[model samples]
Target: MQSVGKPTGSLDPKRHLWVLGLLAPASALLPSQLVTHTGLAFFWWIGPIIVLIVIPTLDRLIGDDGTNPRDEDYERLSNDRYYRWCTYLFLPIQLIGLIIASAMWAGDDLSLADKFGLAATLGFVSGIGINAAHELGHRVEHLERWLAKVALAQSGYGHFFVEHNRGHHVRVATPEDPASARLGESLWEFLPRSVIGGFRSAVALERERLGRLGKRWFDPRNHILQAWAMTLALFATLTLLFGPQVLPWLLLQAVIGAALLETVNYVEHYGLLRERRANGLYRRCSARDSWNSDRLVTNVFLFHLQRHSDHHANPGRRYQTLRSSAQAPQLPAGYATMIVLAAIPPLWRSVMDKRVLAHYEGDITKANVLPRKRRRLLAVRRAVA
Candidate 1:
């Protein structure tokens, strides 16, 4: 395999920009350094600031990037070790940030507001770390799969490794999938369902799989157990090193981080559903079922996770090789903007409900919808018709 990462006739112009992804984990350290020198408390919240404000603005100014490699270029791009290092480097830097944050949280001379800001910073990093984990988790390599769980440890969402690849991918875009958002479902309403539902689904899936492998539910071979064990070990070590005072900040950051990931989930497949077959099985997922964005800045920051339509269509494809499909539904803005919108239910419905309805040609029945709101929505449509 000759180097496809760089060649005179290389296809990917943004290959060097992939390094921008390090900004996410590096955020925890950068803000801390800035605050240390400048004494500006606002810098403590840099991670969220980068996400909520910076990325969205950049998406507007920089605009979309629909570039995709040729089909013939897929294998070389996918196996490029350079791309693998980008994700592999994330885990260690992420852990280093958490350790530094823990030390600061335990004894730093920061005010309460500043401490919370630091926690939010760490939370955003941990949350984004899950996206990195997601890309790795889809790979067939044993090391990448294990690295996915390690990346998830800071957020206490190690079960995501078990649930997302095994559970969410299979059931996505269905009423039965907890991760898929329904029409008229608020983000607040979807949060607990996705969280608890994902956990329960992972447990059940692991139990069933272990039964076949002649292993107990508690067996270390269970991926969920293994992932959670890493989280437990991480937490215990942090507590011992930094003292119990760091625990609350750790927990706060984990919650914030998990929420960040879930907000992405809420935005990704909101009101999108797969059609069922005559045999009662759902149709295989296509790009049509997931919302997509091609904002160059966000795509680079997120490791092309925003090119989600192609991701579901090719789960094992590296982010470098994931293509944007014309068949997929498009989001009005990058996920950074959408995640903020998802938090405000009324505003969210105003922007997204019509889009959902249009996707199914105004047929509410075709959309995955909230059962309680179904009748009212249908009635409104009929009266307007």
Candidate 2:
């Protein structure tokens, strides 16, 4: 299948910046209402519907075809200036939203819908938005890296900063990587695997980083210890201000966000695998390695996250510049819809298994091609069942 081209219409960074900034205010809206009067349950749904569905639809309508591509001379702009501003501006938006939500919880009368809405906003901002920022932060610039950490801090997932860039990306699609979903693995199966695996990988990475600096796991300089300290501090602060009730809600939001991320993971590499070489190393990830989505609506809301093929091919490319590749596997729908489908395990397996088989068949037709590693994973899983 031919991959879709980059957006071809007017492309304005200002528009995206504005939309991202608006997230804080949008999230703050229902919470602000909840603090004063606890009965506006209906308004909670409004924020998510508008954010996850309505706004994305509108973005598609407007279209961000790269009509006004960044000038070649744009590289001369100080990377530090851009990174600091993005971090300083966007990071506070999430923090402000979180504060408002926590305050609302402290108030007496909160409708169930209001609580749900708060959770939804947190999930989007922290999970999807922050995660995207983390990916962007890893660009080859000092400023972007700082902004990425700020984004991660907002989500309470700061370990991702170290683990993703230094750990997950390096080990992706391998059994050792928590972020990678195995072929034929159900969404239900992928969750605990990702969560537990991710945590373990983070610890392992911290140890390695520390070992290089002549420190041990318990050393004060240990990043893993530092991450735990930060997490504990956050919990203590929330417990003191908002009471224990806030903890469950916070975890709920995080779970929702993490699950959304994993669902995307499942779709992106389902039943796809690299070939093992004579030296027992998997082939390097290429454009054809990942599933790509180019649907206009999803791409905009996700900050072009669906351009997975390009991302794997060129990890340092900016979201604005990532292109689709014909060699990559294509998703049937946007990430949001696919996420929903993935929740239904039977339906997800049925739909995706056919796609996997087809891709494998195509590979088999090529001369001198070897069986993909994903095929072995799937076969092993089936045998175990």
Candidate 3:
């Protein structure tokens, strides 16, 4: 057994195998049934209980085998083909869950709380699970990319395909990036900014991308426009077929999913900054640039999204094979706990600001100044008050 924050070079094979054993079946079954079986309050309780008790305990109890990072097995598993297959498996499973959820919502037998719970569950799974698909979607394969878009569409966030790859990636962890939460910004504050800001940026980026190819902003070939249209069409179809009631439920699900996605963005780089050179260019991103989480449970459920530092460094890496980096910023807790903590702005700042300080202890040049900027901004607002 090892401590939660203990440093180990490679993943714990026992923990990894346990995750593979538990998660693959749970992922397949949970989202589909949680919503569909409205009579079962037990299902909802079961998941949170497992997450809180079983996963965390396993994380602590499992010991790591010291495998060298340079091992051929690690190298082979980390390659593109593994990730591509993972992407293929992800899409159909998600679509089936969404369809089952929608069917449950269409039925009149379900209670209000059941409906709300279903929407919430759908939002979590769609936002987190499907967002993983979007990450894989931007890679150099056509099938994987298409599957990613389909997963995004199920969540009604298909524009992420356009925005995240072409827009957000290029501007990540910068002031210009909406998805990048600024220092001292609460999760509540970051939500509107990320959603509205990401949407606007995606449109702007689409126009720019199209212009380069001598296409108009509203051109049918523009993916941003196409995605937006598809999203609206899906909403319209849901509203028409299932009646207007389903529209609110769908929107609620979308909002929940979007909030979860933004909260993730908030945690990943929070206050991290890249230095601008005298020539007014920021330093290029490296493996050390983003926060990484290697907790076995979270990694399997989120498709190794916690290996964010690697993803940022090598944006094309598939989720299955993303590796934990020695130099990356690490999270104290899993994404679920982190999301809850981020809701309280001052607490999040108090905790994460210390992390920023620790990560930059020796080097002032590497300090993320966004927290300072936020402090100054807050002081000015208080003075006006």
Best by lDDT: 1
Clashing pairs for predicted structure model 2, backbone only: 3-326, 7-65, 7-66, 8-65, 9-65
Higher-TM-score candidate among 2 and 3?
3
Mark the regions of model 1 whose C-alpha exceeds 4 Å error after superposition.
Answer: 1-9
Predictions in order: lDDT: 0.90, 0.63, 0.65
lDDT by residue (1-385, candidate 2, tens digit) is 4345744444444344424544533465555565448654555555456555765565456443333234552343323244335435655666677666777666666677678877777766666645555565567766666566555554566677677777767766566566766555778878887777777778888888888999877998765455456656765687788888787777776666666666677677665666668998877877766777776666655656778887877787666556777677777666666776788889987776666656666442221112354566545546755
Ranking by lDDT: 1, 3, 2
| Better model by TM-score: candidate 1 vs candidate 2 | 1
Per-residue lDDT over 1-385 for candidate 3, one digit per residue giving the tens place of the 0 to 100 score = 1122333344334334423523422442574465456745655434344544565566545422222233344556556354455545665665565556667688887778767766776676666655655666667867666666666665677778888888877877777778877666778877888889988877778888899999988788877556567668767876677677687778887777777788888899887776677999977777656776666666666666767887888886655545666677777766656766788888788778767656776333355445547567456546755
Cα lDDT of model 1 by residue, 322-378, tens digit: 777777888899999999999899999999999888888888888998888989998
Please provide TM-scores, in order, for all candidate models, with all chains considered together. 0.96, 0.79, 0.82
Show where candidate 3 strays beyond 4 Å: 1-75, 78-83, 236-241, 362-385
| Candidate 2 error regions (>4 Å) | 1-3, 6-25, 28-40, 46-52, 55-88, 140-143, 362-385
